[model samples]
Target: MASALIEEAHDLSGGAGDPLVHLPDTATALVFRTRADGRGDLVVVGPRTRAAYFAGKDLAVCVRVRLRPGTARPLLGVPISALVDRTTPLAELWGGAAVRLERRLTRLDGDRRLILEQLETALDARMRGPAVRDGLVGAAAMALSARGRERLSDLAPRMGVSERHLRDLLTEDAGLTPKSFARIARLRDALAHGGRSSGLAQLAAATGYYDQSHMTAEFRSLMGVPPGAFFAGRLPALQRC
Candidate 1:
């Protein structure tokens, strides 16, 4: 599998049990289902996107495809932003998301094999035979854990690559540069760490921000709100995630 299992949070005994594909900080989780007859709908979640509350309620089936690095294309048939909290049908995201296989079947009504096959095909295409830069790419991602709060420039040389090269390699594997993903990862880490920050300054310093102003800009751009707003739980969807 191109992706791995990150976490399952809770048991899914009652719902359609689709294989969950874990992605790095930037990859979208494409969810779909397949049938034995070779037909299925595909829902591709885009980068930094969230799913509609109603989506999960109805569709027990989903296929998550983590995008290959350096590839900034939309996942197959689904729009990148379709999952960001809306009641729109999967057809709007992709024609596949609207196909209802279960409604037409008898015994196999709930079987999501068709969707899984389509995803397997898609993954096969993305992963192919072998990776050329697996060593350098994998090393760079693992290195981030050890270099927490350090700037990209400071960590690049130790990984035996230029800062630009490091970013390029990271983009190829994770769909985002090391520093950008790292920043998001750090922010997510801080958000989950849970506590009232003294202020933006303290939060910035803790998350490797050079200063409050810089942290504020970065936070606003990616988070779509001020850093304080996140701390205050103003973004309800994010809080739920």
Candidate 2:
């Protein structure tokens, strides 16, 4: 396998640790990063390939527009469900409007600088279109909020929506239900912290799993590997100071 492409990101504005509002560089997934204080949002366009994390499916295709970083929240303006989560092409999502950006990456025709500038301008504007379902979109963003991720049952009640209803909303906006999203988010957090050396028991407890086996099962389903085998060689590089 090739090494994962890591970009030496240039800070557009604001200082470091502001907040990261980045799109997946591997797919059209929008990610809101509140991992560190003062880190601004880092909007990224994912590479065209299947996500190593999600087996047997194509990653979503879209641009992540980072506005600010600080705990996940309802983005207020962006649509949640308009984009598909499974292997959809970005060109199909934007209907050729993003030709410049795509061409630079695929055809290598235009100046990447200009393409980036155009994308930035569009991101700065508040999104508006017939395809956007703002009410549910806002709710979805709120669902992923820092506090919301911790309390699933409480979230639906607070929103005056049923648990099933909340799941539907999440599926529409995020292409996954609340439970699934929470699971992935928790797992990602655990991996980020534990790396390879962390055992199944530890990762399970941190993510609220009932036992190590449960976490192991989920790991296989989502990541296509058992917990132990997944981190065999990569753990050392992922450790934190």
Candidate 3:
């Protein structure tokens, strides 16, 4: 799995704004947000299959640790399939521990960097616990993230498993089938290069889609907007993913 930890701070104190919608992707994240009132909350953002909205005005500062596909189940102590397309509060999973973390975060009066460090430390402590990681799932996720167009037929052989078994593993560990994961990976690849591309057809071909129309359909389904509108800076809210 290709896990990453990142911290971000957004200042919405200037004015309250509408919630921003985020397109679905493969990774699950641990999100900690602090409001202008010094209240803080911890949430586990599950692997999403559809677009979900979040209010921008509700956040003053935000920190996120993006977990690789097939990795969250171990840390969360539940099958990731249970979290598909869901955003649940950490208190529901971690119980009192989440509450204490929130309390500590609310009490902190420090720079963004300091707050981020504290959050990282808390996450590190959790990682020290036992986990049930699936090596096959991680390897598959890594392959898809790097090359969305990779054939499942070929992938299974490399992983030393039948294609049918691979499908089952992906569903249980990543909350998605190989096909769905590949689609998300391809969409992400296209979006990352959207700003620098000259046209949709060229971008589509480069990103491994059969054609521009194919790419357009997938983009609309996942992003709720066409490539033109999305790259035009008309997104509902700024997204870190």
Q: After superposition, how far is residue 84 of candidate 3 from its true place, in Å?
A: 2.0
Q: Write one digit per residue (lDDT tens) for candidate 3, span 69-167.
A: 566766777777888888899898888988998888767753555666676677667767765454788788768768635688999998899999988
What is the per-residue lDDT of model 1 for residues 124-220, given as tens digits with 9 covering 90 to 100? 4644534436356545655563336456787788767799987776664444556656766665655544376776778777776678888777766
Per-candidate Cα RMSD to the true structure, in Å, reads 7.9, 11.6, 3.9
Shift of residue 219 alpha carbon in model 1, Å: 2.0
Ten contiguous residues minimizing lDDT sum, candidate 1:
49-58
TM-score of each: 0.53, 0.55, 0.82
Ranking by lDDT: 3, 1, 2
Number of clashing residue pairs in every model?
Answer: 18, 20, 1
The residue ranges of model 2 lying beyond 4 angstroms of the native Cα positions read: 1-85, 100-115, 124-126, 130-148, 196-198, 234-241
How far in Å is the alpha carbon of 205 misplaced in model 3?
A: 1.1
Model 1 spans with C-alpha error above 4 angstroms: 1-24, 33-39, 49-57, 63-128, 145-150, 195-201, 236-241
lDDT of each: 0.48, 0.42, 0.73
Judge candidate 1 at residue 164 and give its lDDT: 92
